[model samples]
Target: MTHRQVMEALSGLLLGLFVAVLSSTVVSNALPHILTDLHGGQSAYTWVITATLLTLTASTPIWGKLSDLASKKLLLQIALAIYIASSALAGLSQNTGELIACRALQGIGAGGVTALAQICLAAMVPPRERGRYSGYFGAVFALATIGGPLIGGVIVDTSWLGWRWCFYVGIPFALAAILVVQRTLKLPVVRRTVRIDYLGALAITGAVSLLMIWITLAGKNYAWLSWQTAAMVGGGLLLGALAVVIERRAAEPIIPPDLFRYRTVALAALASVLVGVGMYGATTFLSQYFQLARAKSPTMAGLMTLPMILGLALASTVAGRLITRYGKWKAYLVCGTLLLAIGFGLLGTARADTDYGLLSVYMAITGIGLGLTMQNLVLAVQNTVPRNELGAASSVVTFFRTMGGAMGVSALGALMTNKVGHYLAENLAAAHIPAGRAVAGGGIPDLHKLPAQVVPLVTDAFGHGVGMVFLCAAPFALLAFVTVLFIRETALKTDQQG
Candidate 1:
């Protein structure tokens, strides 16, 4: 493919990326209602989210390895097909279990969409052009991040179409993406026989699955120190150990070990994990906080999050362009991490009594910092790596980011549930109310349905939970700052390769 052809292909792929991200986030607002109507509880609602993350995390490396071995365009087409099929099935799901299963399948496809798009960008463009092109990727992510909730809210609030339409919303877009790919996304196929790493893949998936399940269930369905937790965590760790052995011995590993040999990559991976926790910990629950804690409608909640989204878009694009010119990303990464810490620290002061304007400022600060850091972190890694291993390097960082996100959501979720439960029990006892009768006791409650008297109790409890989580995640952001300090600055490369 010529330069012009590659850029055109990238444009088409980005639209597909927008669709994939939109599908994931657009239905988030309606999830609570979806689960409730399907006779599901908190765990089911979480699993609905968790299953997707788990599958995406596990399948990401597989897709990256495949991109190096076969046809990137063909793999992307297959991914879009899988997404469309899974989404349609999910829309028709009558039970939470069925829906969870379908979403998991959808996540596998989403992983392909994410992993291959990055690989394709690397295959077609040099690291320098990548910085500019990556701005487009960041914009797609921002657009989807913003649009998902707004559209979800509109669909959820529209009594005619209701929440189910949220599930169906992406079908047409997915089709369009597939058609676009077929028309515009052409590439030279990489020819070579490659092993699939089936055993390593299975073991890693199994290990991650076991750990995620344990994280989600422990301290809720069972005690944190229970036999189930012991069995799952222990077994998961053992499986992970086995996976490391397999990767070292395998001819072609799922994730190349040499990638970790570089200190920059190692630190970046760790930073990615921390960034994941700080980013997803609060951002994922922001809509819930607005709608449930503040009694805002879903549409209003979507509108309220616009500042954060806008800040993210502006910062990511501007920073990428600047980084391209200056070739100084490590400083931005450090500054971004500090901003993330400060943003969350300010957010830690949140309460039922705080105003929206103030909260938006804190959120925007976090968003801007995140915008500056998130895409650039990947750019830093991609810039530092050789052309041949770009897929593995990029996929590895992406994997940590996704994995950390899952961990953040699960761990913080557990914290929220526990804190809310304890606060409700204590306060109810003080007021001589029956703790069992308190409807919004454990975790964030459905604010729309809570009694007037209990609304304060629930919202305050949630605010405290959110604040506590920020307190926990702030240090992680700070850790990212420290890690960025150590990343050796390298000159940007402008030549296209391989």
Candidate 2:
């Protein structure tokens, strides 16, 4: 590819990747309002997110395979179209179920965008110069992540727009992304009637979905140790084992068994899993903490979160550059992991009484550590793998990280609800409200309309529950630190030849 060709194609890829990241995150601050206004409950909230993450995880590897077989540009446009259409449907939905279903469809599109963008970039850029460009992609990732909440906040707080606009707002961007890729993106054409590993894909999806469903439902529908957990988790594990058996024997596995043979891939995957655990679990809940516990409006909550985005932006760029310059990555990975653990542990202490400045400091530290660690982990894995396996390697690391986040969000969310529910029940009983009414079917209260006396109690209860989540999360961060320590330092490759 010529300079102009590569640059234009990469620009489109970055834009697509940026918008995909934006879709998942921008909805964070707006979710409580959006669901409540639709008369939905906590279950709706979980499904809305779970559906998207499920589809994203299941379809990502398939997209990577498709990009390897066909024209990347054509595949991207198709993905963008899917995202735009589903996003519009999601915005127009009248009920939680419809919104959840539509969001799943949107996630399928997003899965394609993420996988294809990275693979296409690898196809064009050599490994040596890839680090410099990787920094730019990292910046794009961080920027969208930061921008999503701020934009969501403004839209939700706008009287004329409200929460629906969160979905609608992306439609124009999706359209523009599609058009840009169509016009500027180019790739080598490959013609092949390659059959996908349909059975392997189905097995992996079924296994993952079953387990995630079980996790999402447990504690609420049944106890954590109930028969349902045993059945689903156990069955899920069995299916996963079968998937491994099949993939090892198949001609082409959706996730090849041999990729894990390299120790670096294993460690990077573990580190990614850790970052996902802390980043997704803690950052998402922070919005709830601020808006609900601190009595901040959605707009103000998003604004307050500016520190995290700022930190992410700074670290992603600077870390990428530093890696490019020094040719050493292990120290940064180790340091970033340690910092992430510290940040999350500190954030565990935040409560209603915590000052905004202190809160910002904790979140900034978390964001900085995450920004330094996440993308570089992928780079480390990519460097270790051969060019032919680039798509699979990248998607494998990305898939595992997202899987970690999915599980963390589900597990931690249940923990939060249970803890908060317990607190509210005790305090409400002390305040003479019936325990039954306090724990209502949903453990949700209409804050705007509640009796003045009950609001503080409820808010404090939520804060109490959330503060405990980070404490639970701290050990996982340490596990990640340990994993990163085992990754031996490797020189950064500056050339593009895979």
Model 2, stretches more than 4 Å misplaced?
1-6, 435-439
Residue-wise lDDT of candidate 2 within 318-422, one digit each (tens)? 877777777777777787788788888888898777888898898898778877787778788888888777878888877777777777777788788888888
* Stretches of candidate 1 exceeding 4 Å from the true structure: 1-7, 440-444
Clashing pairs in 1: none
lDDT of 1 at 446: 66
Compute the lDDT of residue 475 as modeled in candidate 1.
Answer: 85
lDDT of 1 by residue, 406-442 (tens): 7778887777667667776776777677765555324
Give me candidate 2's TM-score against the actual structure. Answer: 0.96
**Residue-level error in angstroms, candidate 2, position 387:** 1.2
